[model samples]
Target: MPTEDHQAFVNELVQEHGQRLRSFLARRLHGAGADLPDLVQEVYLRLLRIPDVQTIRSPRAYLFTVAIHVLHQHRLNLASSPEAVDIAEALPMLQARSGDNPAEQVEAWDRLEGFYEVLGELPPKTYAVFVLHRQYGYSREEIASQLGLSYAMVKKHLAQALVHCRRRLDAME
Candidate 1:
């Protein structure tokens, strides 16, 4: 298909069936449905990567097939990783530990917020590797497979992220 025609076809599919697509993912994701947007985006990204959208005779069926694959991958990520506390969920626990003092609570919140801010400043791939390994407990091999990086490159990005974070944290003090 011509590029313009393929794009129009895909856009029409999204406009017509986006809600059903989201519902399908949300059902499979269980309570992890907060990631609905990301999963949806992943499905579209995979669709865009296909060299010949014309070969897909049934676009809606193909779209759902892609969503199922994405969901399976998402489950694999969650299952393979150890129990991991999302940082947003952890912030309240940190506040509780800092006690009832308003000033201490504020300071604790500020520090955690600042730490995440520093993380956000890293290069995108580096940040992803660090989060998948440290925050989600993914093995380097798994991260390399998922992110399409070499195992050595995953290690490199992770190390760079750590060093960058450490320097920023020390400077913050």
Candidate 2:
């Protein structure tokens, strides 16, 4: 099919069924479906990448088929993921043992809040890069390979995470 025709076809498919497809993913993904927009975008990107949209006799079938593949991959990624450490819980242990006072407690809580705020601001993929690189000690190349991303993308994510963390921590000071 011509590029314009193929684009129009994909656009029409999305316009017609995007909501249904998103709900399908949300049902399957549960909590992880918070990134439903990104997942939906990935489905669209995959559909657009097809060399010949004509080959897909049924666009609905093709759309759902791609969505299922995306969801399956999502499950696989989660299954392979390492458990993240709960730093908020662990922060108290690192504090000065003698200072069981209110002021010290507040300081620790503020620190934990700052940490979580920074982490919460990141996209799930960017947060994954931070944890994989900082907590799990994976090299950039390894992270890229495992996540099926480019090395440069890994670096960009890591940098954004670091910058955000630094700014948040600085504000906490």
Cα TM-score per model? 0.46, 0.46
Name model 2 segments beyond 4 Å from true. 84-173
Q: Write the per-residue lDDT of candidate 2 for residues 41-134, one digit (tens) a residue.
A: 8888888789888776557756876776665456445645665311101011123332546676556544543564456566656767776777
Query: What tens-digit string does per-residue lDDT give for candidate 1 at 74-143?
Result: 7545544555211110101112355556677657656755665576566656756776787668899988
| CA RMSD (A), model 2 | 18.2
* Deviation in Å, model 2, residue 71 alpha carbon: 0.6
